[model samples]
Target: MRKPLPFGISVFVALMLLASQAFAAPKSDLWPMWNQSNEANAASFDHQKWQQILDKYVVVKGQHNLFNYSAVTPSDKALLDQYIVDLTSLDPRNYSKDEQFAYWVNLYNALTVQLILDEYPVKSITKLGGFLSFGPWDDDVTRIAGKKLTLNDIEHRILRPIWNDERIHYAVNCASLGCPNLAQTAFTGENTEELLNEAAKQFTNSDKGAKIDGNTLTLSSIYEWYGVDFGNNEQAVLKAIDVFRDGQKLEGWSGKIKYDYDWDLNQP
Candidate 1:
């Protein structure tokens, strides 16, 4: 008969294994910028269901992108503020690389929407400047998991790192009419592929964004913001735009219309 292993050793090994698994998984889904499930307008909370989704992804405590935040959503602004524990208070040393990225992206979006809600009736986010002389979008006042984070931190640091893919720009929205309509579902790494594709297709194809009038082109200014993301150069970007332009020739598509941004919160 073999002697039983020491309790301390056994517990240590078990904990180590558990920790490994946590890092192996990613946190959250890769849904579009504005994702609300069925009854999205309701903005109801389903803790069990939400945990199930987050469980599939890795969780890095205290880790943040450039911004101190690690997750944010239109509805989350209230939930996190009122209920969810501070995620950024956790330790970053324990988080995996992908886990950190996931956390930061979510945080940025969450805080942004929250900022808008803070001043819901405003005509534009640009009007939110204060003594800081900048919008909350430029604020570095939150934490992710357990690390300090800011809005820019999420966009340039993490999201840009993992997918260096420009289409992502179209996927991550800023809660403005000029931005893509937010999806009503969560964004998980599992469905990131479909999410990105759909966003690109949706924005480029919609006449609301870019349309062709017998060669006269009307394009969303997004074609101008981080335009390089659409292509290596403007020409390359135009090529990507053409995919959603309904086979219209870019040469003759020359319709000019002033671009507009809806400042209202993307809600029902």
Candidate 2:
């Protein structure tokens, strides 16, 4: 009989496999409980409080935006906390799809800012993770409708699976410089679609998003991480982002593909 591997080696191998799987991008699996939406519900969720928070802290610099994390006052932090509490007080499943869309987006962004604030002075959002961890994405951030939810739960489970929109990658900021810019304005039912298109355009045009030099095409790791959402194949992925490209399109020429991401905190 073959001897069993040493306990230390066995544990190490298991941990390594678990770490690899944890870092892989999550699939868009629907959490059916959230799929309920009442199209007849005409009342819109108020996002002005969230907008005020965004307007006060978000500093727009060219195509990118940064948040002044250190400058936030205790009073403002309290207001942010209240905003989250007010959001979860109501059952979003009773609202319309448009209302739900804006609700989730604002909630996600607000929660992300709160997470960074909770651990301010950190070099990267990834540093917020515990031992042998990547980031706080999996940490339970809040409870909505009595269901505990994480950042990953909101993005991958609720938003991505429900909307099935690739533009979500832009709207949900990751509190990192490499991720798409966090919008300065709060997303509303009326403005969500417009903002989504604008974000797609801006990120695609920015050097941090996509840069093509000669026959080499370099893209943000967002594409590589969630390439399936854009379209599994390279050609399809390029086509998906092509419409948003402001410069010479990546049509006609075949080039090498490369992916990179910056994990520095998106703070000023």
Candidate 3:
């Protein structure tokens, strides 16, 4: 026979569930990028607050979005425009090594976000191009840490070698609504590990990379797009994802994955 539960135990169980519902702070919500979410929209990041923060921190530049964690709503094209202006005005050359790294990562992500915002509400990023293109990833006008660089530069030159982390490809979203939700915060030097891991987990756990359906696994194009980085082929990519995923095994996954893309603005 089972013993009866104590009165205090019963109350404690109820409290535990209620406490969980109250929502604990997410270890990973501090973004090194931007996203348009209802929660982010509610914030009113004041310009004054940012100026003050810059005065105190090692921020490489004084461009917009550097201190604009206000959680504004919708995250329209106008915000991206202002941020680009601010980003270009910043001078990473004046900063220290670590400070410059942080600045470039942010600069790459910020300009990309604005590109999407400029073509808001579109279905496919390709539509914005003149003839045949996947969008602005090929464009040269994108800025990074106050310098004019292409999306390719930010990815291949800065993020790849210095960081040696392909996971960043997933972090610096292109802002197509179909892209992973724009991160709600900026990536700061202080919380680099926390934010990067969070992004990897979110992208892998979601349909973007790995999905569960009893025994079968459905994957995202990211695996294929960067397969060379993962390994010579698909198996290597699955292995990388497996390292981050818990419980869920790669049992039968061989990188023979499905592909899906959303041309949306990733907007709310």
Q: Any runs in candidate 3 off by more than 4 Å, and if so which?
A: 1-79, 142-147, 251-256
Better of 2 and 3 by lDDT: 2
Tens digit per residue, CA lDDT, model 3, 21-48: 5312111222233211232222222233
Prediction RMSDs, each to the true structure: 19.6, 2.7, 19.2
- Give the clash count for model 3: 12
The TM-score values for the models, in the order shown, are: 0.60, 0.91, 0.63
The best candidate by lDDT is 2
Model 1 residue 186 CA deviation (Å) reads 0.5
- Give me the candidate number with maximum TM-score: 2
Model 1 worst lDDT window (10 residues): 60-69
> What C-alpha lDDT values do all the predictions have?
0.50, 0.88, 0.53
Residues 1-268 of candidate 1: C-alpha lDDT, one tens digit per residue: 9997799998888767764442121222332321212322323222333333234322322211111123334454456454223445543334443333334444455556556656665555545645423345557657644456555556755566445776656656565555664433444534556766776777766665666565356667666555556665656767777775555546333345343334443333
